[model samples]
Target: MNYILSIMPSLFAGAKMTLILFFWTLITAIPLGIIVSLGLLSYFKPLRLVLKFYIWIMRGTPLLLQLIFIFYGLPIVGIIFQRYDAALFAFILNYTAYFAEIFRGGFQSIPIGQYESARVLRLNYWQTLTHIIIPQVSKIVIPSIGNEVINLVKDTSLVYVIGLGELLRAGNVATARDVTLIPLVIVGIIYLLMTGIASFLLKKIERNFAKWK
Candidate 1:
């Protein structure tokens, strides 16, 4: 217990970076995912194929590989970013592909009859999508989206591989320096707290959506 207190500060400092990485990735990925979802739904065959390939490539590869490529591979082309930013860029790109697929699946689950009904009412594509499609899709995908959010919180630790010093890395450093396992425990607690808060908010959203059914 005393050792736990000693490692708290180091764990907390790393957790801050973890939180920042998680939050920004969520913010950037959600909108980008929506856009990618739209592209996948596009009527143009060529555009659809191109986007499909892009998504496939991103989704098929491990995120760690993507991070290594962005951080190290890009430097060969003179696109050097700080380690943190490089990690952030890789995370956003990787997660955007995943979230886009989630959104696409939700959109596909919508009944074709709904689109027909909206068309009968003379609603345009954008209007129908915004009012009719997006709302239903959001509700349908909420659980899955929440899962991704939880995963994102844990994945923030992966950035430490790129030298971001996020929570897991901080815990390792502390453990090495202080010769205590408490730092790892502290890291676990911090992750639990963040995941707990996210779960609470997602549950609230679930409740709100449930009201419609």
Candidate 2:
């Protein structure tokens, strides 16, 4: 217990970085995903094909590889990014592809009649989307989005690959230095607590959306 307490500050600092990555990725990626999904659904065949290829590349590759490529490989081509920026850029691009697919699925699941009705009522494209389509799509994709968000929590640890010490990395350093697994155990517990809170909040959001059904 004393050992755990001794390392709490370091672990907390690492966890703060992890949360920063997670929150900022969510803020940026969700909207990017939406825009990508809209592009995928666009009438322009060339644009749709390009976006589709982008999504395929992102989704098909390992995120760790992507992280390394963005951070290390890009510098070879004269594109340099700081470690944090590299991690964030890779995470947002990778997760945006995933979220784009999820949102695309949600958009397709909507009945055609709703769109026709919106058209008949003379709702402009933006109004129809904001007032009708988006609400229903949000409700439908909540569970999938929540799952992705939880995965994002875990994935933040990958930032350590670029030497940006996040929670798991901090624990790893402590374990190596102290020659004990206690720090790792503590880190796991903290992760569980964070995920538990996220799950609970997601359930609340789900319930609120359920009222719309």
RMSD of each: 1.4, 0.8
Best by lDDT: 2
lDDT by residue for model 2 (29-126), tens: 99999889999999999999999999999999899999999999999999999999999999999999999999999999999999999999999999
Q: How close is candidate 2 to the true structure, as a TM-score?
A: 0.98
Query: What are the clashing pairs of model 1?
Result: none
RMSD in Å for model 2: 0.8
Model 1 deviation from native, Cα RMSD in Å: 1.4
- What local lDDT score does residue 17 receive in model 2, on the 0 to 100 scale? 96
lDDT of candidates 1 onward, in order: 0.89, 0.94
Where's the lowest-lDDT run of ten residues in candidate 1?
1-10
Candidate 1: where is the Cα deviation over 4 Å? 1-3
Local distance difference test, candidate 1:
0.89
The clash count of every prediction, one per candidate, is 0, 0
**Residue 14, candidate 1: alpha-carbon lDDT:** 87
